[model samples]
Target: MSLRTALVAHVVSSSFYLARARILLSPAGDNWLRGRQRHFEQGGVPMRRAFAASVALLSLALFTLVIVASSAQARSERTQATTITLSGWSAGKDEDDLLQSVVNTFNSTHSTIHVDYSVINGDYSTAMTARFAAHNPPDVFYVDSSVAPSWIKQGVLQPLNTYIKKSKYDTTKFYPGLLSAFKVGKTIYGFPKDWSPLATEINSAMFAKAGISTPPRTWAQLTADAKKLASSGAVPGGKPICLPPDWARMLAFVFQNKGSLASVQSPAVTAAVNYYVGLLKQGLAATPTQLGVGWPGEALGKEKAAIIFEGNWLLPYMKSTFPTVHYGVAPMVKGKVNGNLGFTVSYSLAKDSKNKQAAWTLLSWLTGKKGMTLWMSKGLALPSRSDVKAIGGRKPFLAAGPFAHGWGFPNFSTTITVMNNDLQAVINGSMTTAQMLADVSKSLKG
Candidate 1:
């Protein structure tokens, strides 16, 4: 600083101290500093002492300024760390713990981006709906195939094409069917972290007792096997097959019959539904609920069912919950083609997120090959990325990823409820299959 400016600053500092201590400097807001000699001569203290003190105080003030500037920069840097909020629903405690560990790993390895994660264990859709309603949803969250369409329609999810292109992220690494689940037209909204396709879980002992050495490869064979198991009377508490009255399961059948959602009222769709309900009607297959089980997995664990169609998630559940339940995994029975519903979730970005870049960093890392491999190693779900190999007996689930039908429909929550209710009604003899087809066709159209 200039000499005059330094002297003026010194006077201001000295004057503050003097006011506090009830003392006085040449007081005129440093006006007397311009006439330093006259002020020193008239103000009655030794001029040398005053000049020396002012110079010392001026140097101190400059030092303090440097410290303040450096401290401010440090504060700025600390505040620059981007915080991303992530949310999802866990399949079980093990899956929850696994995901939390992955999140912890990400946070530790990343310096610029930090993630705050939460698991919405109960009704994840409702919780996330509330967040989006308030325009304060988490930066990234699990967007399941069933909800992707509706969320995209609501404009809560941002398109990731720009971020992907800028980051040069390898989208091609993901299974095309799984990745396309979150894509609306050509614009990709998110990347699948991992995926699972419906696969048959057959109780080998039950099949063996029924004298069936091979798992069914086609719907006809499945029917024959179910019949043999039902008539054999060797099956335990469960029936030949334990199926759920879920629209998701219905979609699997619909796809297997070569019936797309585009042809909801087609003959193929009707035939698929008939065949599924036929097994139930003939007492060969029973809904898990009818067998006094919470879900198909529960039925499988309790040995209540000889077979169940579930995702690779069943493998982990079987290992932890029912270790003695010997089973083999096979692709879902084929109809006109090999059809399985791909149950997948993507790490989707929120449209209202202020930290888009940081959120993308976390989302991409979780979906990237390395991060996915770390997660897939736990063997809870099959890797969505083609480059990431399946661990344990995950190959059956992984093999279906490329050709699996990534099924989803508009107004999915409502549509699923309707479809499931209708299917169950038909199963319980409250409605005819024709009636269900007509009602669902109307709903699907409307």
Candidate 2:
């Protein structure tokens, strides 16, 4: 029987037993029983039968109280909700606020689960790794595609196949490219929360001042426009573009040229590198550090550069922080192929989490169609699911989704770190493009 039914039966039984005992011990009942005992002595009733009935009634009363108390304790446990912790890194105030709002909604809506959301402001992977090592990891946390392989190898993430099956979550709604990043063999470790593909951002005022009417459509056009903007002094210090010297940023060009970073000697790779080096040589492009800025977004916001290649996250940043800067976004410049790089982070449940079911509930809600739509409605990130429509001026970002490639390289974090450290030499002319590629390839192999 159901616990509720069992509890109701126990309560009724206890009340019945207590009533019987009270009647037996009452003054009127005692007088009547004594009269019966007197009659029994006269051979009308049995005295031994009366005494045995009193003993049995008293024992049942005490046993019924114990059972009632045990039933009450069990019912309390069954009604209580489970609470789980969620952890993630925040890029800025806007991103944090949006995440907290969604989390609030989930906590309020779920009757059986409570989520405590925490933001780790510093290095995300390092902080999360420490938590895992100490056996105090959050029940659910964000995992970047770049570092997923290593985490999977270490078996720190729980395989989500069973939860997905039991919940009947429609995994097919998500972009396959992003979803595959969290998979090892046939097991999925997480569900992608959101994704952002690199797109070209151009300052409209700068473009108009340089006599350019529209954003560039090809690599050659981009280079020509940069040169024109630089010569016309439309950008600060006559630098037309700010490109971060990182492989993550440069990979778009490699992929556009139909090249793989794994094969540095291929003609396509050589062509892609040569194109970037040529722009640097012409003084039309500068890295963010060279312009005394921390990132491409800042350089564009401050008018240090007329154009930049950045992610969709820049839209919210620009709206809130750089409100006066009029700009337009377009898909990344094309080459032999249409290519743009997509970066994504997923919600993963910890393998050792004590509240696994509760954690899964939060994960499912956060990455589900309704929750994801709410989170991406602000346009801080693009929705990973196909069914979620872009709201709040996210058309440009959504337009780039078709041809965007995810960060799927094996050991992606280490490879990007090595490239970021070594590629600066090539940009500054200390090393040739070929040499830089060779060095990066060798380091990755090692």
Candidate 3:
């Protein structure tokens, strides 16, 4: 019998209490109970004895009813298998093979709870928000670090701190500074999965043709080097480096300038903006249209531009599309400060999920050792956990993945527009450095 069934038996055996009481209350029962009763003593039972016997019988029946109900309650709470749904942005054809492998592994081992996964199109932000508004959100979904703050403000994400503490793996096991992107107040909203650093993808052939032997290590060095390469007439395009002073690239310069996006009062932002504009004026970088480059990856493949600052994702595309192009990866040079932007995404649970425990099971499997290793094997972004770096080291392609000082890009949610537009203006020569930063600072107040 099951433990539940055994417990029911114990409850039924407890009826012995009522049986013993009934026997003691009866005159015959009392005589039988006496240790030393005179032989052949026979007497009729008293009215009180008869009344006590009737009462004892009634009590015993009531007691049995209670035990039956208790046993029934226990059976209702038994463990049962559950089904959970997961949502993410791994819908692209390129990501299909890796994502499907992860889902299959989880489904095989977690027979009690199967994960029903769906990959939404485009960005997860747009798709997830719409689903939540419709009141039919998935149990779990992808949460990019860049957009986590918006979700937190909407009160949509759940905190995983308590769960993390109970986990065998500690938070410190992953890279520091990156986790805060998913935090609001004292609660952590998401689990960081993978990250890539900002780096320059150089065409070695282009560099050699330009009579350049070294990649620049600082902003000044980059400008000077690009100038030298330009004068050599060896660069395929008219310009040597294809730097776009767009909002994304501008944020990196702002970070490297020791400027906080949300600082109380600091002028470092202006300095960074000025530097970016200066580079544009000096012709170190070009706008997309000017270079006739539709995509950075395609541009690099066609050798339209010699050098471009991009993240780790570009590596695979370059290898597959431009297999013959001799290329090498170099770290992001120091601006006024040492910093780089991290292209990162995380897995987060819904605040109102019906199956919280089952949902966590899927999350635990995906972000844990097994899930991380499977994803890393595809040679995509680097894993957040330190131990997983060994897998990256096994392949030459992954070793050259984007990272500087072994750190990925930093998240700066504050002054996003200012960082975006201000730097673009400066680079495009539409605004001065001071004007761009001041405009950005004012924009932050809105």
Candidate 4:
């Protein structure tokens, strides 16, 4: 073959090969090389890849900023001056003011913490249960003495034993009887914030009109005077002065009768109930419901009743609402048992609370003399602290009158239940005192 023909054929073949290669690989190859060059310029990232990387970096920075802001907000919450909500039952103006003063004082003293107080209002038990179920419970709440035991059993309250131990307070600083009320098993669920002596507040003028000089101390004397009061009709409201057939008081009477409502489940409680029923039948005392829709306090306050068995807390209320009334306080009429029935309230810490330390601090301050002073000033509660009494004794209340140093029956929640449930049923003629004893014994068994 001629050299020219061969060269032409070779060139055509080479051209054909180059054309085929370009058709098959040019677009992808060009893109890959351009990407590689861009990557080298951008620290080995392809153009598309660099764009994706830039978007990722921006997204990460935004996410980091969001996280930082959230953390900052959380930190602010931990140190904010806004209040930690405190939930409690509704008290009248005087009581509210006293509690507020304590809270305000604490807030002013401690710049880091503020307590926002709120009243749970009526049906406190039901409201608390609902709130607990919602997992939005109040940071602090007032627990009643009678109900604290049941709540502890149900695990609704956190044991305060650890906090109590860590506290600078000495448990012995309180009255042994009052301190014992808040103890459950081996743990203390609460601390005593206030206490009261149960006393019979009487209309001295009525007693004088009835020709009685002193308050009755024995059941027999009480019965006699009560009868005379009923017959004399010298009570201010023009109604016969009489004791209300209260189950709680009846239980106290049973206790004074040298009878155990449930402490010993014998036939004595039944006898006690029978005796109370007889008292009611004899018209010595009227049922609370029959007193013209008046509570014992109202009855006494309005002068419809000349006497009432109540706590010392009532004196302030009586003085504030019924200023001109002449009244006297005396120890509860003695029972044959020769002892007083009492109930005590205690403040406790919450186990699951986030501000446990702060809670403990508040509790410590409130239970101490400072809190006691606030409470005493309002006359809403009696101090559990003996020191507070020593600091400002008989002069606090007794200076205003002769009949101070009043006393109440000694009983805790367990005894209160017996008094209210078993003893009450017996007194109301719903059950024999024996039945009440048995029922209470059953409750105690568990």
Candidate 5:
């Protein structure tokens, strides 16, 4: 019989024995026993009856103990199973599937902790904010490097330093740049799950049609090739390159010039802006919107543009959507330095989580070497942990990690908004490069 069935039988038997003993000890039962003893004259009837009652009582006590032990075991098992909620924003179907696979692996391996994952379909920060406000935030959630500074300042996240210290988790195994994005002072708030570095995606067919034998390796070469590609009418819209005017893409140019958004008026910043503007003026490059596409990747995939700058995330999208298009990925065209923008998201624990310890176990397993290796093996994003080697197409992204810079800062959100607006004005010929820089500098200060 099953253990539960056996326990139920023991409980029932014990109750029956105890009930019989109670009846036998009653006044009526004692009088009957005396009558039997007088009639028998042997007087051994009372002694035999008393001995039988004692044995029944002992059996009842033993069954009762067994039942109690079984109940305790069931309670302990229930107590050991902890369910934790993990929330994150969905990147795409491939990334989502890969993450779910990893989570499934974690759940299967861990007996005590269970992670219930939910993907926020809309704005992740806004959704997480509402959860925090309701005092029912998830045990753990994703924190993008772009908004980490703001989230950290808001105190919605729990610092992982104590847990890291107690568990002796090797924090040094992660890429230093990616790790720094989630840190404030000496306390780390999250662990990077994965990262993507910006790189150039070129269409070999388009290059060959334009009579170009090689891809550009430097900004000057890129401009020269763009000119030839545009003049040759290799692409349908006659645009040689499509570059998004957003700060994420522009930041690479700024950093390569040894400039920073923090110092918008620096000579390096001005040069970077002017160079991009010049390309637009010469009709060698067009923004993705101007090319009538949603993003640079789409522009390239649709053959609306010959060259574009994008990250590793584009690879899967292109392969699935535009499989026939032949393309090659190269490191970002060189400037003063071999600079590329890195985008990363980390798994952060909620400060108010009641199951903080359980949540940390899930977080550690997800970002641990084995988990990261499994996740990265799909080639969706490069592994953040140094101990986990990059496989397949992820190697280039990993190689660029050491030199890449993450896009996280206290004022990064504000800077991105202001810079994008001001740069768009410059590209439209409504504002001069100097004017754009001065305006951005003034806005940043305010």
Candidate 6:
């Protein structure tokens, strides 16, 4: 164990050190500490002097204690909190701010564990993979459900089963489906922090203007509604729906048709892909890029699309960036049955971490009720734990929770890159749906 003493800055910067400082700064303790210092100086023994300076240094930095503190009034041993590094990709400035604030609270309240939060820029999975290969990864990092399979296979994650059992952590609180997504066999790898199930978001004003009263309930009705909205020109220079060529989004339709990534060449998958791309082909749907926006959420907010399919993460963005945009969320339109894609992420521990127990302290708190409630209650994303209770118009997303399927591929990054290209190719008419399915099926085999 490395004990690097802390230099506390705030009056109550770190409770462990601050408690001692409070005593040392008092009139009676001040005189006592001073007397001990002179005795150590005259004797040429710097223990007392170092002790005094340690109290002073405690006022400056939040680190480990360097010396043993002794006084006639009390005798106690103190040390700095274990520094645990945590990294994840940022969703936006607002989300980053909220997470930072939460981490600050964790640091102050936790005397033995301090979490250092950093956003890994660019591709999250790619950067994390490199760090793991270098044997210098953060103590804890986000494990997106889409990449969990590959990460689990690589053995870079510290299994959470022992920690959970030892702590008697209640695993049943989280939604079973979400929790299962982070598991391999019976070994628990991580705890889901939050989840979002795909749903349809409709522009209220546009739907009314198109003479449609409600969001579409099925694929057929969605197409019919889009045609009416297009003919009415309600969106003006934009299409009736915004559909991104993402496997995560498309997988919802596949599941609805009783298909899965298990067999990309299945008849169910074929029908699902064709139906999804046909909208783009018929000019009733447009990608966010076509509408000059960054994401489907932005396209909806900018009124570039009458409808869009997204998860609950869009709620906070809409609230902050486009509060005035009148919209309604509904379950994703069905094919043969109800299905939706669930996106979840967990705070997983690194196998190479020097501070596994300390990292668990931070990780557990992050996914625990207190930390999760403070973060997820803001409508930032749907809470994975059922008791946390979603806020503000979240029923539609919750409705799809039962039939929602988690997304991940064999070789996550490479598979997604191939899937994304083939999906876009079919959408843009460069490739046929049949060719796309065959290629995707081939990639799955490889």
User: In terms of lDDT, which candidate is strongest?
Assistant: 6
* TM-score of model number 5: 0.82
lDDT string for model 6 (159-275, tens) is 999999999999888777777778888898898888889889999999999999999999889999999999998999799999898887888888889988888888999998888
Worst 10 residues of 5 by lDDT: 12-21
lDDT of candidate 2 over 1-446, digit per residue (tens): 65456445645765665675577679987887787666656753465565555556546555767777678766775578788999898777878888899989997788778788889879988898898899889999999888888899888999999999998988998887788789977799999999988888999999999999999989989988998997787885638988778878888899899997568668898888788767777788888888899999998898889989998779877987899999999878899888877798899999999999999998998899989988976767789998998776677777767777777566666677777777888877688777877777776574
RMSD of 3: 10.6
lDDT of 4: 0.63
TM per model? Answer: 0.80, 0.79, 0.75, 0.68, 0.82, 0.77
Model 4 / residue 426 / CA error / Å: 5.2
lDDT score for residue 386 of model 1: 84
Q: Which regions of candidate 3 are displaced past 4 Å? A: 1-79, 390-419
- lDDT head-to-head 3 vs 5, winner: 5
- Name the regions of candidate 6 deviating beyond 4 angstroms: 1-77, 289-294, 319-323
CA shift at 252, candidate 4, in angstroms? 2.4
Q: Rate the local accuracy (lDDT) of all candidates.
A: 0.83, 0.83, 0.68, 0.63, 0.83, 0.84
Encode model 1's per-residue lDDT on 1-446: one tens digit a residue: 66677646644554353353332234563555556656666776788578767657655665555565577677886688788899889777778888889999998898777798888878999999998999999999999898899899889999999998899988988878887889989999988887788888898898999999988888889999998998897477779998888877878888888887777778888898888888888888889879998999988889888888988778767888999989899878888888888888899999999899999999999998778888976777788888888788777777687688666777776777788999999988999877887777677665
Using alpha carbons, what is the TM-score of model 3? 0.75
Ranked candidates, highest TM-score first = 5, 1, 2, 6, 3, 4
**Model 4 C-alpha lDDT per residue in residues 364-443, reported as the tens digit of each score:** 77878877777777445666776765222223322211212212223444544564655446556687656666666665
Lowest lDDT block of 10, candidate 4:
399-408
